[model samples]
Target: MKTIGVIGGMSWESSTEYYRLLNRHAKARLGGHHNARSLMLTVDFAPIEANQRAGNWTALGDQLADAARQLERGGADLVILATNTMHRVYESIEQAIDVPFLHIADPTGNALRAAGITRVGLLGTRYTMEQTFYTGRLSERYDLETLIPNEAERADVHRIIYDELCHGNVNDASRAVYQRVIDELAARGAQAVILGCTEITLLIKPEDSALPVFDTTALHAQAAVDWAIEPV
Candidate 1:
């Protein structure tokens, strides 16, 4: 198996999920006491969060780039950025490493396409919801129409991600609020709902919404597993 590198800890809660899922899927597929050949370089979340809040991506990108180089140097064959919002720096981070950085957006978009989803609703952190960096890539690169919740609902979703899920507290009440948002999105012509926050799939599931749900975390993890097991 190829070594998969992880640029993680935007919130280690979701990062932990990435590691677990990678191992779970790897063992299931290869059928042994196998775990993913992995290298994880976890960044300090406080500074990264502060940088995002201040709109200073230069330092954040530099930090991630440095981590990518380290993961490569540590014998990682492929890299995966373990957070959705932090993928804002994906381009620069990709340039910093020679190994493949499996974009969190690509596999999710591909999964949506494979499921026949054309228009989709997205729930994520404020930066991810409002920015063109992520949604633009899905729309322009993958030809998917992305619909974000309105400012009010967006704030609620963002709060749930940062103040709740990121902190490792999954609240049932939060899930109810998101369920309403998902219904509204389906009414707005969304064929599916994309959990753009890696931590969200932990709170809500497809059963919570009337439409199909594509989990960014699981799709990204599965894609990484597939790539890791491929012939070197």
Candidate 2:
């Protein structure tokens, strides 16, 4: 198995899910008590969050690039950033390391395409929702149309993500709020909803949404397993 290097802990809540899903899928694929060959460099999210709030993306990118370099030096075969929002620095991290950097969006986009989903709803931090980095990639690479919540709903989604989900606080009320947003997105003609934020999987599930659900964290982990077991 190839080693999967992870840049994690932008709110270790979702990072923990990445770890669990990676190992679990690896075992499921290989059987016989097999697990992923992996290394994780988890950073403190406090300063990272502060930097994001301050719009210090360059410094944040540099910090994550350093993390990717550390993982590569530690002998990782390929690298993955465990958070969706931190993917704002995807280019920097990709350039920092020699190994393949598995982008979080690729697997999700592939799955969406395989399912014949052309239009999708996205729920993530405001940066991910409003920025061109993520949605533009989907449009340009996958021919997918991305729709997001309205401004007020976007604020609520962002708040629930940082204030509650990041801290491991998953409330039924917040789930209801997310369901409402998903319904609106479906009404807007979204064929499926991308749980664009990694933490969102904790609150919303396949059965809870008005549209089909695509969890990026799960898809990314499964893709890592596929990469690990593929013949070189």
Candidate 3:
């Protein structure tokens, strides 16, 4: 198996999910005692979060690129950025690495297309929702239409992500708010909801939504496993 490098800790809460899912998928695929061949370079989320809040993407990109380089030096064959919002700086990381950088969106987009889903409701950080990096890639690559919650709902989602979920505080009230947002999106003709934030799966699951729910973290980790174990 090829080594899968992880740039993680954009909040250790969700990075833990990536670590667990990667091993679970690997064990299920290869059976018995098998586990993913992986390397991880976890960053301190405090400074990264500060940069994000201040919109200092250049510094964030520099930090992530350094992480990718460290993974490459550690002999990783490919890399996965374990958080969705951090993928805004994916290109910088990619440019800094020789190995393949698996984009979290590619697997999600492919899964949606395979399921014949054309319209999806996305829930993530405000940057992911309002910006072009993620939604634009899905549209350009898969011909998918992405819908985000309205301004007020977007604020709620973003706040819950940073303040609650990233800190590992999952509240019942926050989950209810997310369900309402999903319901509203479904009413607006969203065929499925994309849990675009990696931390979202901590609160919402497939059974929580009326529409089909796609968890990007699981999908992204599974894709990494697939690539690592593919026959050469």
Candidate 4:
């Protein structure tokens, strides 16, 4: 199996999920005593978060590129960036490493296409929701149309992500808010909802949404496992 390199800890909460899902996927695919052959280089998110809020993506890109290079040097055959927001700098990381970089969006996009989902709701950091890097890729590559929560709801989603979810705090009140948001999106003609933030799955699950839930963290990790164990 190829070694999966992971750039993680943009928030350790979601990074833990990536690790769990990767091993779970590996075990489910390979049966007894099996797990993913992987290496995770976890960064300190304090400075990363500071840079994100300050709009210093150049520094973030350089930091992530260095992480990717470290993983490559450690014998990782492929790389996965564990956070959806950090993917804003995916191109720099991709360019910095020789290994195949598994973009967090591609797996979700492919699954949405196979399920015939044309229009989808997106929930993530304000940066991810408002910026072109993510939604633009979905439209350009997957022929998918993206919808997001209204401005107020977008603020709620972004706040919950950074303040609560990042700290591993899951409150029922927050979940209810997300449920209402999903219902609102469904009302707006969203065919499915992309849990575009990695930490979103910690708050909302498939059962809680008004539409189908595409959890990017799970899809990304599962895809990494599929790639790692592909026939040589």
lDDT of 3 by residue, 1-232 (tens): 9999999897899999999999999999999999999999999999999999899999999999999999999999999999999899999999998999999999999999999999999999999999999999999999999999999999999999999999999999999999999999999999999999999999999988888999999999999999999923
lDDT of 1 by residue, 175-204 (tens): 999999998998999999999999998899
Query: Per-prediction RMSD in angstroms?
Result: 1.1, 0.9, 0.8, 0.9
lDDT of 4 by residue, 166-229 (tens): 9999999999999999999999999999999999999998988889999999999999999999
Any runs in candidate 3 off by more than 4 Å, and if so which?
none
On the 0 to 100 scale, the lDDT of residue 113 in model 1 is 85
Determine the C-alpha RMSD for candidate 2 after optimal superposition of all C-alphas.
Answer: 0.9
Instruction: Spell out the clash pairs found in candidate 1.
Output: none
Q: Cα deviation in Å at residue 203, candidate 2?
A: 0.6
TM-score of 3: 0.99
In model 4, the worst 10-residue window by lDDT is 223-232
lDDT of 1: 0.91
The residue-by-residue lDDT of candidate 2 on 33-64, one tens digit each, is 99899999999999999999999999999999
Per-model TM-score, in order, reads 0.97, 0.98, 0.99, 0.99
Q: Which pairs of residues collide in candidate 4? A: none
The lDDT of each candidate is 0.91, 0.94, 0.96, 0.95
Candidate 4 at 2: error in angstroms?
0.4
